[model samples]
Target: MKLFVDCKKAGHLCDKGQYEDASFFEKLSVRMHVMMCKQCAKYSERNAKLTKLLKDSKCKQMPEECKKRIREELARELAKKPE
Candidate 1:
C-alpha cells in the first residue's frame, strides 16, 4: 500500500474520511500528508469546521419541485446563451 500521497489525493481522502467512506490506508495517507503540508492541514481543518457547522445548523431541505424548477430555469438560461 502507498504510504504517501500528494495534496490532491490528501484532499480527496480527507473528504472521504469526513463521510466515513475512506479506507484505513487512505486515512493514514491523508494524516501523513496533512502533518507535513500546512496548507492541506488548514484545508482539512476548514473542511471539518464547515461539516460541523452544517450538521449543527437547522437547515431545511428545499422541496423537490423547487429544485426541479431551478434546474429547468438554469437550463433555459444556458440554452439562450450564445455558443
Candidate 2:
C-alpha cells in the first residue's frame, strides 16, 4: 500500500472522507498528508467545520413550485440570450 499522497489526491480524499465515501486506506493517506501539510490541514479542518454546520442547520428545502418557477425564469433568460 502506498503511504504517501500528493496534495491534489489528498484534497480529493479529504472531501470523500468528509462524505464518508472514501476507503479506509484513502482516509488514512489523507490524514497522513494533513499531518504534514499546513494548507491541506487547514482545508480539511474548514471542510469538517462546514460539513458539521450544514448537518446541524435546520434549513428547509424549497417547494417544488418554487423550483419550477426558478427553472422557468432561467429558461426564459436563456431564450433571451444571444447564441
Candidate 3:
C-alpha cells in the first residue's frame, strides 16, 4: 500500500514494468520515484532502450543438434575427471 518507493525498489519495479510483470501500483510507484530522481530516470531510460533493442533484435537460437553435441562432449569430459 506504500505509494512512495525507494530508488532500489523503483529500479526493481522498473525492470518488472519493462516485462509487463509489475502491477498498477508498482508501476505508479516507479513513475513517481523516477520523476523526482534523476539517476533512476536515466537508469530507467537506458533500461528501456536496452529492452527495446533486444526485442527488436531478431536473435536465432542455437540448433538442438549442436547443443546435444556440446552436452555429450561435456559429459565425456566430466566422466574423465578423477574421483
The top-ranked prediction according to TM-score is: 3
| lDDT ranking, high to low | 3, 2, 1
lDDT of 1 at 74: 96
Write one digit per residue (lDDT tens) for candidate 2, span 1-83.
67799999999899998899999999999999999999999999999999999999999999999999999999999889587
Residue 40 lDDT (model 2): 99
Candidate 1 global TM-score: 0.73
TM-score of 2: 0.80
The number of clashing residue pairs in model 2 is 0
Instruction: Tell me how far the alpha carbon of residue 3 in candidate 1 is from the true structure, in angstroms, after superposition.
Output: 1.1
Q: What is the lDDT of residue 19 in candidate 1?
A: 90
Q: Would you list the clashing residue pairs of candidate 1?
A: none
Give residue 77's error in model 1 in angstroms: 12
CA lDDT, every model vs. true structure:
0.93, 0.94, 0.95
lDDT of 1 by residue, 6-49 (tens): 89889999999889899999999999999999999999999899
Task: Go through the candidates in order and give the C-alpha RMSD of each one to the true structure.
Answer: 4.2, 3.2, 2.4
Candidate 2, run of 10 with poorest lDDT = 1-10
